[model samples]
Target: MLDSFSFFNIIEQFIIGYFLTINTVYLALVVGALIYVRKQMLHPSVVKADALFKTELFKSISILVPAYNEADNIVESVESLLKLEYPEYHIIVVNDGSTDDTLQRLIEHFNLTETDIYFEEQIEHEQIRTIYRSPDTAMLTVIDKKNGGKADALNAGINIADTDLVCSIDADSILEQNVLKKLIQTFIEHKNTIAAGGVVRVINGCEIENREIDKIHVPKNFWARLQSAEYIRAFLFGRVGWDYFKSLLIVSGAFGIFDRQAVIKVGGYLTNTVGEDIELIVRLHSYHLRNNEDYQIRFLPEPICWTEVPTDYKSLRNQRNRWHRGLADSLWRHKYMLFNPSYKHIGMFVMPFFLIFELLGPIVNILSYIYLIVVISLPTYFNLTFILLFLAVSIIYGMVLSLIAILAEEIVFKTYDDFKDIAILSLFSFLENLGYRQIHAWWQFKGLIDFFKGKKSWGKMVRKGFKE
Candidate 1:
C-alpha cells in the first residue's frame, strides 16, 4: 500500500540510519585512539629502545621474509635486514618457487651455500627443495621450496626459526634500523605479549642509499598519495583504537612480531586464505581466550616499516580485491566467534563489528550511491532539499573523521616532516572522501562478489622496487 514517495523516504531513512551507526562507531574509535595515543606520548619512558638494547633482557628474534617472484627487490631487502640494529637476530628468507631468478639472485648476491639443517615440522607446508645458509655471515638462511602461497612460505620459515620471537615482513619492505629494538621492548615490558604490529608507511617517493632510507617524501603519483592518506588514517586510528579496547584483530603482515612458541602452539598460519595475517591474529585471540590464558596482542604506533604501494588503478584494484576477499574468507572461517560471549570483547564486539561494518560496508555504500543517483535523476521520486542535506551531513561526517586521523598523525609520529607535505596530505584527506572513497568501495564490492563466487586466486600485484 506504500506510495512511491513513501518508499523513497523509507530508503533514505535506512541509509541515514546505517550512516549514523557506522559513523558513531568510528567517532568513538577516534576518541579512544586519541586518548590512548596522548597517554603514550606523555609516558615516553614506557619502552626505551636505547635502554633495551644495552640490557641483556632483549629477546632473540628471527626475521622471516617470504618472497614470491621478488627478484628485483630481494637483494636490497636482504641487505637492509642485515643492517638492523638489533643485537641478536637472524634473517630467514623463503623462496616460494618463483618463476623469476629470485633464488639464483639470492645465491649469487649473498654467496649462499646449501646446508643440512633439521627443524621440527610444527606446521604443514609445501615440500622444501633445499635450505641454504650464508657461509660468510652465518646469520642468514634461505629456503628453496616448491610453489605454494604466501601462508605456506611463512610456515616453512617458522619451522626453521630457532629464536624466541618471529618477525614477519614483506620481501619488498624496508625496516628502520631500530625497529626490532623498539618492538622487542614491548615483549620485554609485557611478559604476556604474544604479538605486536607496527606502522607501515609508503616508500614510493622516499630517498634510499646503501639500503637505508635517506629521506621520506610524499609520493608524486596521485593514487599513491591517496593511499598514503589512507594508510595514515588506518594505522593512526584504526589499529591504535582497537589496541585500546584490547580487541585488536589485525597485525599487518608487512611488519609484525610474534612469539614463536605461541604461533607454533596455535598451529601457525593457515595456508588456504590470502588474509593469513588477520586470520592468525583472530585465532590467537580465540585460542588464548578459550584456554583462559593471560595474553596480549598489541599494535605499536612507533616502529615503522616502509613498503611500496600500487600506483596504477589496475594494480590498486587487484590489491584491494585480494585484501577484501581475504577479509571475507577469514571472517567466514571464524564465524563461530561472532557474538559468542565466552570469548569476551573479541567475540562479542570485534568480530561482529568487522562483519557488519568492515566486510559489508562496501555493499551498503554502493547501494546507497545507486539509490541516490536514481532518486536524484527521477524528478517524481526526488526530494532535492532532503537529498542534499543527507549527502552534506554524510560527507561532512566522513571529512571530520579523516581530519581527526590527520591530526592524530601529526600529533603522534609526524612522519611527514615538511609542512608542505602535511598540507598536501591534509588536502588529500578531504579529497579522498569525494571520488577515491567511491572507487575503493567499488573495489571492495567487487571483492565481496568474487568471494561469494568461490574465487580464491590472488591477482597480480606489480611493484616498482623501492628507490635505492
Candidate 2:
C-alpha cells in the first residue's frame, strides 16, 4: 500500500487538476467579457439606453405568476405588479388551488368578476375552476385551478397569455420598475434572441417601504448575510462570465422572459421536473439545435427581482436541496445534449461543466475534505503546496468573484448606501468560503443521494410573507 504522503499527493493532484481545468475555462470567459463590456460601456446598446424605457417600440409581455398557498403574498404581489412602469403589459395570476385563502384574497382584492374570455389550452394541466377578471383593472386576470405544481400552473397561465412574450415570476418576487423595459429592449436589439434572464437580489433584511426595496442592507444573521454575498458572486461574476462565453445553461425561475412562440413550439413547461425554468431553457436550446435554427438565450446584468432569502438554517437547506435536485433533474433529462457537437458551445462546454462541477462537484468536495483531514492528522503526509493551491483556486477565486460583483453593483445600480454594509459584505465574502460553501456542497450531495434513493420531497419554505 502507498504511504500516507503518496495517498495525499494523489488526492491533491486530482483536486488541483479539476480545479485548474475549470478555472482556465472560466478565466478565458471572464477575459472575453472584460473586452466585450469595455466595448458595450463605450457604445451603449438599446439594453443600456435609459431613453428606451420611454419608447413605444418595446414589446408587450404577459406576466405569468404561479402561486400555491400564497394567500399572504398574493395581494401585495398583485399590488406591486400594478405599480410596474411598463407601457403595456398584462398579469396572469394562476392560483394552484391553495388550501389557504389565496383564491379568496385575490378575488376580493381585485374585485374580480367572471368573464367569458377565450383561452387556447395548448398544454394539458389540472382542471381550471374558474377565470375571473376586473373590468377596472384591464391588466389583471386570475385563473383558479386544481392543485398543480408550479410548472402546471405556468402552463395554465401560458394558454391564456395573449401577448408575444411570457415573463415567469414567483409570487414572492418583486420586479424593479425598469426591469421589463430593459429586458424588452434587448429582445428588440437582438432579433434572434429567444429568451432573456435578469438578475435576482435578496430581499431579506432589506429596508422596504411601499413594497419596494429602497436600500439593500446586509442581514444581521450570519446565514442571511452569507447569502447576500453568495448571490452577488453567483450572478455578477460567475453568471456574467458564463454569459460571455455564450454558454449560460440556466435562466433563473425568479424572473425570466421567453418568446411565446418559441416556448409553445418546444411544448411548453415540463411539470415532471422541479426545475421547470432550467428544463424549459434546455428544451428551447435543444429544439433550436435539432432544427439547425440560429437563436440566442441572453442575460441582463440588472437586478430585476427582489426575493426574500431564508433567514433560518432549515429553510436555507430545503431551498438548496430543491435547487440541487432541480439541477440534477435538468441535467439528467437533457443528458442527450451532453457533449453533442450539434449544440456547439452549450454542448461542448456548458453541459459538460455542469455535469462535472455543478452536479457532481459536491461529492468530489466532500471526498477532498476527508482526504485533507487525513493528511493534516498525519504530519508526514501533508503537502503544503496542495493545501495552498486549493486555498488560492477555490477560496481566493471566490473572493475575486465577490469583488467583481461589488464593482458591478456600484457601476450599474447602487443599492447599498451604508459603508458598514459594504465592509460587512467584504468580510462575509471571505468568511463564506470557510463554512457556507461547504453547506451548499453538502446540500447538493444530499440532493444527489436523494435522487438515487428515489425519494421525492418538495421544499416548503415558511415565508416571512410579502411586504406591501
Candidate 3:
C-alpha cells in the first residue's frame, strides 16, 4: 500500500519526530528544574548538622568506598571523606581484591592493622580476605576481600556498616565538605525518603590544591570541555526534571546516599548487571510500590560531588559503552515493570522513555543519519523545506537545550566564576551536537551489541591522577 516515495518520506519524518520529541521532553525538564532550583536559591541557608543531631530523624551514616586498583587517587579520596562536615559518620573502604599496590598504599598511609571485626553475611559476596582498622583514626575501617565487581563490593560494605545509612561513593570521587549535611536533609525532612542522588560535576577543569578543589575553570581539553557541558545538561536539568516529575530512575553511583535498611530490604545491589546504579534505583521503586509503602527517591540539584571525566577518546568510548550496556541490561532485567499500572510513573512514563529514547536512540539516530546522507547525496525530489525543518528541529533544537542547561547552572550555582566559562560552554554546546554526538551514539550502539553478545566485564577506564 505504501509507495517508495511515501516510505522514504515516512522514514524522514520519523527521524525528525524522534529527536524533536526527546528534545521536547528535555525542554520541559529544563523549565521545571529552573523553577525549582531558582526557588531553592532564595533560601540560601543549609540545614545545620548540630540541630539535626537532636532530632529523631537524624541517622548515623557509613561512607562506603568500593575500590579496585585505585592506587592513584585512593589516598586523596580517603582524605576527602575525612574532611566531610557531618556528625556521627564512619568511613568504610572496601578493597575488592586489587592486584596492584592499592592495598599496600592504604596500610602505609593509614597505619591499618588486621582486625577480626565480624560482620553478618546478610548479603552474598566473595570471601573476605581480612578486615583492617586504622589505629590512627577511629572512623576509618578497611575490608579486603576476593575480587568482586563494584556491586558486590558495595553489598559487602553495606553488610559491614553498623550505621543506619550507607553513602556509596567511587574511590575517585570527592564529595563537598557539606555534601552529607545537604544530602541528609532530604531524609530528615521527608521521613519517607529512601535514597537521594547528588550532582556529579567534572573535576578535570577545576584546580586541585592540597588535595582539595580550590578553583573552578572550564577544562582546556576539547573533549573534557564538551563533557562539562553534557554533565550540566544531564544533571542540572535532566535528572532534576525527572525528580520533579516524581519518576527519577537513576542516581549516579559516583555519589549517592541511601538508607541502610531500605537497601537491604531491596536485597542489596545486583552483581549481575554492570548498570548496578540504575538497577538498584529501579528495584527500590518496584519494591516500595509493590509493598504499598510510602517512599521518596530524590535528586538534589546542588552540585555535591566532583569527579573526573575522561579527557581522551578511548577512555570516553569505554565509559559510554559500559553505560549503554548497563542501561540495556537493567531495562531487560526489569521488563516486568514496563507499562505496568501497579508501578505508577516508573512503569507508565520513565521505563518507556528509557526503552525507546534512552536505550534504542543510538540505533535509530545512526540509521536515520545514514538515510539522510544517502538521500541528500542523490539530489532527488525530496522536499527542501522538510529537510531544512528536520535539521532545525533535530540539530538546532538539542543545541538550544544544552545552552539552556549551561545558563541554568550559571544562574543557580555560579560554579564557573568567569563569564567566559559560560561562553566557552555555549560554544561547545553547539560543537558537540555536530560530530561528538555521532561518535557517542556509535559507542552506545556497540554497547547494546555487547549486551546482546552477553559481555559483562566493565571496560577499562584509565585514571589520570589528580595533581594536588
Candidate 4:
C-alpha cells in the first residue's frame, strides 16, 4: 500500500503536469495570436468608408435586434444602430413578448405604426403578433412576437430580413459608427467569408453622448474592472488565436455578421440550444465541409461593439453559468465532429480543445484546489514548501498570460488612451487570478451541473443599462 506522502506526491505530480500542459497551450496561443496581430498591424486593411459608401461594392445588410425586457436601453441601442455609417442597411427589432414596456417604448419613441409586409418563413419561429414600421425613419422596423427565446426571436428576424447579409446584435449593445463599413470590407475582400465577428468591449464606464460612445475607460466597480480585463484577454488571445488556427467556433451573439443565404441553407439558429450562436457556426462549418463547398468564418479584431456587462456578483454569476452551459450544449450537440479529419482543424483541434480544456477545465481546477487544501491540512501528507512553490508558480504563470493578453491589446488596438487606464487594467489583469478566477471556476462548475440536470432556461440578468 502506498503511504500518504507517496499518494500525495503522485497526485501533486499529476496536477502539476496538468497545469503545465494547459499553460503551455495558452503560451502557444499567445505566441500565435501575437504573430497574427503583428502581421495585421504591418499590413493593415485601410477601410475607406467614404469610398465604400459611394460605391456599390459593399453588400446590403440588415441589423437584427432581439429584445426581451430591454426597455431601458432599446431606444438608445436602436438610435445608435440608426447612426451606423453604412450606405444600405435597415434595422429590425424583434420584441419577444417582453412583460416590460419594451415594445411600447419602441412604438412611442420611433413613431412606429402597424404595417403589412410579406416575408418568407425560411426558419421555424413563434407566431408573430404584429409588424410595425416607423414612418419617420424608413430604415427601422419592429416585430412583435410571442414569448419565444432569443434563438426563436433571431430566426423571426432572419426570415423578415430582406438583405444580402444579416448582423445580429443584442439590444443593449452599441456599435461604433464605422463597424459595418469595416465588416463589409472583410466580406468584399474575402468572397468566401460567410460569417464574421467583432470585438465587444465592456461599456460600464464608457462616456456616452447622444447614444454613442464618447470616451472609453475601465469601470469603477471592482468586479466590472476584473471583467474588463477578462474581456480583453478573451478577445485579444482566445478568439484571435482560434482564428489563427482557422478553427474558430464562436462569433459572439452580441455582434456578429453572417451571410443570409448561408444561414438559411443551414436552417438558421438552433432554437432548442442555449448556445445558438456556436451551434449555428458549427453547423455552418459542418454543412459546408460535408457538401464540399468553400466557406470562411472569421473574427476581426477591429470594428468594436461596446456592451453593458453585469456589475454585480449575482448577475455576473448567472451570466457565466449560462455561458458555460451554452458551451457544453453546443459541444455535445456536435460531438460527432470530435477528432474527425473530414472537418479539418475544426474537428481534430478546436472541438477537442474546447471539450477537454474549456468544458472540463473548471472541474479540474476546483478538484486540484481541494486536493491541495486537503494535503496541506494533513500534517503527515503536508509539504509546506511544495504547496507554496506550486501555488506561486501557478499564479505567476497565470499573471504572465494575462499580461501577454494585455500587451496584445495595447499593440493592436490602442482603444484606451489614458496611461492611467492602461496601468489600472494591467493591475486588474494580475489581480483577476487571485480570487476572481476561483469564483469563476465555481460558477462554471455549477453550470456543468445544471447542464447535466437538463436545465435550459437562462437565469435572470439585471442590467442597469449603459451609463449615459
Q: Would you give me the overall lDDT of model 2?
A: 0.81
Candidate 1 lDDT, 137-236, residue by residue in tens = 7899999999898999999999999999999999999999888877788799899999999889999888999999997888999999998889988987
TM-score of each: 0.96, 0.94, 0.97, 0.96
Over all chains combined, what TM-score does candidate 2 have?
Answer: 0.94
For residues 1-468, write the lDDT of model 4, one tens digit per residue: 998678778888878877777888878778888888888777655445456556778899999999999988999999999998877999999999999999999999999999999998989999999999998999999999998899999999999999999999999999999898877777887899999998889998889999999989999989899999999888878887778878789999999999999999999998887888888999999999888899889987777889899988999999999999999998898899999999888888888988988899999899988987887788766788768756865677889899878866986788899989899999999999999999999999999999999999888898898667
Q: Give stretches of model 1 more than 4 Å off.
A: 45-47
Report the C-alpha displacement of residue 406, candidate 1, in angstroms: 2.2
TM-score of candidate 1 relative to the true fold: 0.96
For this target, which candidate reaches the highest TM-score against the unseen true structure? Answer: 3
Query: What is the descending TM-score order?
Result: 3, 1, 4, 2
* Candidate 2 error regions (>4 Å): 1-7, 29-40, 43-55
**Model with the higher lDDT, candidate 2 or 3:** 3
lDDT of 3: 0.89
What is the C-alpha local distance difference test score of each model? 0.89, 0.81, 0.89, 0.89
Query: What value does the lDDT take at residue 47 in candidate 1?
Result: 53
The residue-by-residue lDDT of candidate 3 on 1-468, one tens digit each, is 999899888887788888889888989998888887877777542644446655755789999999999999899999988998777899999999998999899999999999988788888999899999988888999999998899999999999999988999999888888888777888887889999998998888788877889998888989999999998899989999998888899999999999999999889999989999999999999999999999999998874798888888899999999999999998999999999999988898899999999999999989978877777777676567667877888788989889888887887788888889889999999988999998999999999999999999887888887766
* Each model's backbone clash number: 0, 0, 0, 0
